[model samples]
Target: MQPINLAAKLALIHEHWMPKVVAEMNDYQFKLVKLRGEFVWHSHADTDETFIVVQGRLRIELRDGAIELGPGEMTVIPKGVEHKPCAPDEAQVMLIEPRGVLNTGDQGGARSAPNDVWI
Candidate 1:
């Protein structure tokens, strides 16, 4: 395989909220996303979702509370937990989730992007 340059890879992305696949292993997929605004409330019933911020900041809002994550910070949202992700400005992030995971979880909304297709 060719060498993977994360810096160069991250430079190719120009959109927001859409995640681009960077690598995959076994049943999991690793993705990079640049985000802004608010995402629809959703949940994954079968797999946990991990988010790692590479730059800027993000917030995950749940029914009970919310958590703010900054650059170099990471958090895992357990399966079946309803949550919404938001960013005041813009944030670069990495995500780890099971293959075939739908970004909107079971409850799809207007914000749900097409799944499985790598950007």
Candidate 2:
């Protein structure tokens, strides 16, 4: 396979909260998603989720507190922890998680994007 450019892939995305598959390693997938405003509170029961900020900022609000992530920052939210993601403005992010993990976790609804979509 050839190398993938993050900037070029990001430019092709136009929807917020929908992750587009970029690459894969073993059982994990690398996905890119845009964020703005608030996301639903949810948790993965089986595996942890990693969020890497590519541009702008992201805030993950937990039941007890919140974690603010800026560009170039990353965080891993352990499995089964309830949290909500929010962004003050448009933000680009990369997510690393097991293949088939849902974007909305157990709280599937209108916000849940289709899995395994590629750019």
- Candidate 2 stretches with Cα past 4 Å from truth are none
* Among all candidates shown, the one with the greatest lDDT: 2
In candidate 1, which residue ranges exceed 4 Å CA deviation? none
Clashes of each: 0, 0
TM-score of each: 0.92, 0.98
Task: State the lDDT of candidate 2 residue by residue for 1-119, as single tens digits.
Answer: 89998889999999999999999999999999999999999999999999999999999999999999999999999999999999989989999999999999999999999999999
The TM-score between candidate 1 and the true structure equals: 0.92
Name the candidate that leads on TM-score: 2
